[model samples]
Target chain A: MAATSFQRILVALDGSDCSFRALDFACHIAKQYPGCTLVLVHVIDQRALETARMVHLQPMVEEIVRTLHAAGESLLAEAEAVPKRHQVSATTHLEQGIIAQRLLACAKEQGCDLIVIGSHGRTGLQRVLLGSVAHAVAQLAPEMVLIVREGAAASAGA
Target chain B: MLERILVPIDGSPPAAKATTLAIEVATRFKAEVRLVFVVDDSIHVLAEPSYVQPDYTFFADKMREEGEQVLAAAAKRFKDAGVKVTTQLRNGYVPAEIGASVKEFKTTLILMGTHGRTGWDRLVLGSVAQGVLATTDVPILLVRP
Candidate 1:
């Protein structure tokens, strides 16, 4: 069998420490295969915005959305450092939607062969097999899904 | 840096697809492959031996035979790809057995197919991939083949 390459990988980052660990795995894969590229996508969940709108007035909701979008952008920018540290070429995307759906859609839109995400992210329930986003993407992603557990890379190397 | 890759097979199409990917990955990365076929002894577990003395042993033996065949076929594929490989024929709860073997093998990566049940059926059956994902701390390459 010929070697199967992960040509383009989409990584979902949520500005969480674990998400950065997922980025580490994606970078490792990118470096493993020559010419492989990375697509870093951070989604601003619309559901959070909806909840804000429900609880607050329109002006307050707009302010929250703006702040969330800014946070997402900064998260992507921070995540970009991992690929750069590895000298891998990557593209960044900031989008708004349901967290898991938007990540899958980004994978489809970017034509990524693999989708990588942390096992859990910010606000995840402790001791859960997967955070809700990881569970949904693992079940529903169109392309291959790589659910990266935190500290797995270190264990693999050791 | 994938040092050891674990592959679980059950002779399904997606399992074949996953094995193919595992072979390719092992070959490229020089990773050792630990291939396992777990004879899901759910029947034996659910029906205790002292309860009814059903002929479940016959079915368990048959399943073991099938598991061996599947394991050998997949191991052969990996061997042909010039990958270092080992095979195991285990009988027990499938997911739990896999989790145990992951620790036994010191597996770094798990590559397996999504047990293709969508919608309500998927919810009902509960996937092995999901179970293993839940129990293990390794990175899982879940292929929906």
Candidate 2:
């Protein structure tokens, strides 16, 4: 059997600490396989903007959406820097939609063989209310899914 | 750096797919593949009284034998592919055994298959993969058949 090679790796970045950690891990993996490209993705969740519009004035909602778009762009910029620093080739994607659905669709569209994500590790009431995007992607994605925890790299070192 | 990859098989079709993926990963990383077959005797012990009863030891022994067969077949595939492979048989709950094996073997990654259970069935039975995710700190690579 030929060894599984992840030619194109799709990593979800949301500017969270854990998400950066996942990017670091993905970069390391990309370095291992020669010519592997890391695709950095950040989704501007439209549902969140919709919720803001429902609870706020039109002008306020527009301002919030602008802020969100700016944040997403900066997050993608930061993610791109990680791979650049490591000398790994990468591309950035800014998307809009449900976070998990967009992520799955992007991975398929990009022809990514692997999807790397960070788990928030939420529990109890908060988890039920917020739900886990990583969990949903892991359960549904056609490609292999790698769910990186907060301290996964450190734990692996020890 | 992944040094040891743990994969649990139960003689299911999904398990076969997981094994294939695990071997591919191990071969790429030059990591050892540890194949574990968990003989979950708890299911038998917890069965309804209406269920047929056999000697506990007899049932366990038979399960162990079957598990060994499953492990051997999986091990051969890895060995044939030139990946260093080891096999073990554990007697206990599936998720618990998988977690224990991860710690005992110092596994760097766990590559396992999921049956993709959803809706009411998922809530009622719960998923072993989800249980492992909650209990273990090791990184998991979940593959669907």
TM-score of chain B of each: 0.88, 0.84
Candidate 2's residue-wise lDDT over B59-104, tens digit each? 6778789899999999999999999999999988778888999888
lDDT of 2 by residue, A1-158 (tens): 64346889999888777678778878878887778999999988888788877877667877878888898898898789889999999999999998889999999999999999887532223243113788678867888888777667677888
lDDT of 1 by residue, B1-145 (tens): 5779999888888889889888877876899999988888776853577866665677788888998898988888888878999999887878899998888999988988877322233552237877787678898898876
Candidate 1 lands at a TM-score of 0.91
Please list all clashing residue pairs in model 2, or write none if there are none: none
**In candidate 1, which residue ranges exceed 4 Å CA deviation?**
A2-4, A150-158, B45-54, B116-126
- Name the docking class for model 1: medium
Chain B alone, TM-score, model 2: 0.84
The two-chain DockQ for each candidate, comma-separated, is 0.59, 0.52
Among all candidates shown, the one with the greatest DockQ: 1
lDDT of 1 by residue, A1-158 (tens): 54445999999988877788788878987887888899999888888788877876768987888888888788788888889989999999999999999998889988999999998888668587888999899878868888888656566666
Candidate 1 lDDT for residue A157: 64
Model 1 DockQ vs. reference = 0.59
| lDDT score for residue B59 of model 1 | 77
